[model samples]
Target chain A: MSATIHFTIDGVEVTGKAGQTILQAASEAGIYIPRLCAHKDLTPHGSCRVCTVMVNGRPQAACTQPVSDGAIVENETAEIKELRRNLVEMLFVEGNHYCMFCEKSGNCELQALAYRLGIQAPRYPYFFPQRALDATHPDIFIDHNRCILCGRCVRASKELDGKNVFQFIGRGAHKRVGFNAPDGLGHTDAAVSDRFVSICPVGAILKKRVGYAIPVGQRLFDKRPIGSEIEARRAKGK
Target chain B: MSTKPKVATTSLAGCFGCHMSLLDIDDRILKLIELVDFNKSPINDIKKFTDRCLVGIIEGGCSNEENVHVLQDFRKHCDVIIALGDCATMGGLPAMRNHVPLKECLEEAYLKGPTVYNPGGKVPGDAELPLILDKVYPCQEVVKVDLFLPGCPPPADTIWQALVALLNNKPLELPYELIKYD
Candidate 1:
């Protein structure tokens, strides 16, 4: 039998099975910790730092850090929120995220998080960096303009689809996602049905010829906040 | 001799679509008119500032000398400046050229584009034209922006709520539906 761990997040008691990370525990307990790179199924990459939470008075990546019995977790404090906001803002300026015309505007997790965080505009200057677009694939395309380097595609392609189709190249501001081929994504064994194709949190990876099929008002995250679903879990638990 | 607070507005590298959305407040404009007076706006065709404005509504980023001059002028004359729409907040569609060299852009537009048929095969460099900047800059980057309302045009309701809150001296906490980036 798996042991259950008990922890308090923001003074609310929560329980989780042993070997679960703080994020997984908090999520099951209906506590929403803002995150960008940590998907439910994929292993935590901890690149975005949007899910940084205070564990026993020290900061740690909740998605990567394991939960401990009687551990004190602080997720929604003012200091942590401000830090998360800065991280999100930097992500905005680092890339040329033209959200206004983007196909993933309403449904994008990054864009929705910005709204949830009350980011009317980024505090930093827009970098307006020059990025590339790879459209060699017949069914899929990669627009580097909107990528946040969350590493979702890299992890999903490797772990879920069991394919080495996506990988990261470069360093620092020059870093970008690269496909597994000398020529392009088309040359790689990447298929439209691959998990990597639909796992991107932004418009970085998208299927061709299916843009803007959903209208603005009817789209996901249009009327509600991004973590509303997770937060909704609170009511169900009670 | 108007007693209401005066407001001014302009579009730099923008389409004036934000201004149209402002008017999309529909009949709430009657409420707006009762609260504030138009000082210098394309709406009233008041070409130049006649009074010190309580608020300056600026749309679009600074893409050229004229845009910079107008924005600096606004900073000097207005008490509060609101950067409205994606262009003013974060260099919208016009900023797509930020990555490309200016020479290439001019060449493509005037000399080498598919639709271009320049008889002289020359880029226009008239002295009357406003000098283009190296890159587009958001309104806040150039000057102090008191507030930012983002979106393609910020939806008329969002603009109305923001303006109303500002005029009434209330804290502007936008609702979920009113604060979309697109």
Candidate 2:
């Protein structure tokens, strides 16, 4: 039998199984390492480095880094906070993320993270690259302008739904999420019941006819900050 | 004569929703007047800054030459600058046009739009009109902002708290509910 691995995240002692990553350990200990691509239901991609934490004086993506016994992990620090702010800012400018008009205004993970990181405005120049929107699908739509390419939807479509319907197309700056169907989302076998509909962390992929169903001040992260649920669960551990 | 703090406010490239939200302070507006005096603001409809103000609140992003000019004037005349809304803090709804080419945006609005009154294909290129910028820029990009309060139109309570903190010479601490992007 494998022994439990113990680690300290920001000086908080945490324990996890031998195979669990540092993020998983710290998360069980009630410390929320900010991440975009590391979802509970899917395998860690480590594509977004928002969850980078200092381990043994070196920076490492917590989602992918396995927890070792007595590992000293510094997840919250002034330096890390500043780094996250810049990353979030870059994400904001790299796309046409006009949160004021987006249906996912309050519910978006990116937007919530921006608020969490205290990013009033992006310091970088707005790229404003022209993108497209695909509303061909009758039930769902994809607005490419809002896509951050975290690969959550792509991973969910393939690993969970067992239908490799989505894949990343192109390379470098032109790279974007594309479906397997030659005709677009409309022709794809993706259904509303698939995990593909709920895996998107932004307004990029959305279910049609359900925008603003919850209304402002009633949505997730409206009053309660993101990760509060995890933090609450952590408190209950005490 | 009262020794209340003097304040100025302006809106550029933004809907007056922020200004409306400011008035949304409701009955507290009377309390606000008792706390601070308005100088150059749409609320008072003051065309010019009567004198140098202590705090200047900008409620929109810079989308044209005129916006830059006004922002610069505020920077020169005001002691502290506060970006007051999502538009001012980060180019809000107007920044959506940033993706489209400026020429195309103009053409869509003027020459080849769904609703255009002109019989002849003509665009508004009057020399007197303020020249539009290629993309909308948040107030911080154009000016040194001392503070930022972000929201589509920050809740009236948030604005009031910020103003009170500024007047009282204390650090502005906002509650979670007061902080929202929409």
Candidate 3:
């Protein structure tokens, strides 16, 4: 068997077993690549486009792209930073994201990502899409406006709970989440205990009746950026 | 082209963010427009059409009389009526104030509070606005809904995948990563 392959990240070489995504190698070597869509427990989706890197002079999503021997990856670059800023701008314009008043204001992934990327104002015209809030369920409140569509909750429904209750509908900009049957969440097959709510990455899908329950300073991931949290978790092998 | 479905969308009561989010599919909007006939969205003008569409999406909550009528019309016209966004599915942010009484809201917003034309007149018995329901409710509370897409609004890619699944008659399956809110 051949030995592990070594790759260079930000001019520092890192070695890892074959078939690891660039994010894995970067995290292993204590290099931080910002990401919004990549989760340790769920399958990686390059939807947010925040974890992009310059690999051998090409822009690629570190979460989805795998590493190979002798490959050189640039985790930080001016062009990559600009691209991330644009991606964050698109996400901001694509929905009615008013983070200032949101309960998840300081703890939000989108907000954190914006801070990391230094986004001052949404450059694009706001889509100002009209979204809804679902509080019929006794345990969860779904806020459609803030959703970035990372699809973590959808995956949790399918994988952990084995209930195909939540789903996406329509195409393109007209797309949105929906239940399998004609009935709303109350009438659908999903239960309150389903893991979908816990896995949601934004305030869009929330735990019903639990807003502000966690004190301002006590919320997890509120103080530290996701990059640091990921590094810490990796350090602990979690 | 003949086999593709015709889809229409509408919103009521709550903000129109869901419809706008749908339009946020960006370049994919052109691709979707190519695949279906978008007949009666707020963004488009399709007059004198009723009950002939394949898919009908109604965003926002049914808080007023007009909302009720619109939902009824969608139910009558489309083969499937999807309650898109949280408001459509469960009475969103507007419903947050559901704990308070409607008269109290009116008094604060219109009569007792700030006034452009302090309609010093007594609260009209027959305001054009529909009477508020006792408790805020989702679209399915008033009419039949074919599907419910949760999220504050579901992610764009998830929405795309769902639509593709519907178009292809395949089971809609989103990766677990799409569902997390944290």
Top of the candidates by TM-score: 1
Candidate 1 regions with alpha-carbon error over 4 angstroms: none
Q: In terms of TM-score, how similar is model 1 to the real structure?
A: 0.99
Taking the tens digit of each residue's C-alpha lDDT, what string does model 1 give over B148-176? 99989899999888888888899998888
Instruction: Give the range of the ten consecutive residues with the poorest summed lDDT in model 3 chain A.
Output: A119-128
Name model 3 segments beyond 4 Å from true: A1-3, A232-238, B1-182
Model 3 per-residue lDDT at A221:
50
DockQ of 2: 0.70
lDDT of 2 by residue, A1-238 (tens): 7689887888887888898988887777788899988898899999889999999889999999998998889988999988888888999889888777788888999988887876767778778788999888999999999999999999999899998878999988899999888788999888878897888999999999988888888889887877787788788988
User: Rank order by DockQ, top first?
Assistant: 1, 2, 3
Ranking 2 against 3 by DockQ, winner: 2
RMSD of 1: 0.8
Distance (Å) between predicted and true CA of A102, model 3?
2.0
Q: Which ten residues in a row have the lowest lDDT in candidate 1 chain B?
A: B173-182
Please write out the lDDT profile of model 3 over residues A1-238, one tens digit for every residue: 6468888987877887777888887888677898877876667778777899988888889999988899889877788888888988798768866553477755787877765665434445444555777766667677888888787777788878888878888778877888676756766677767888767767887766667777754655555655785567546753
Taking chain B only, the TM-score of every model is: 0.98, 0.96, 0.86
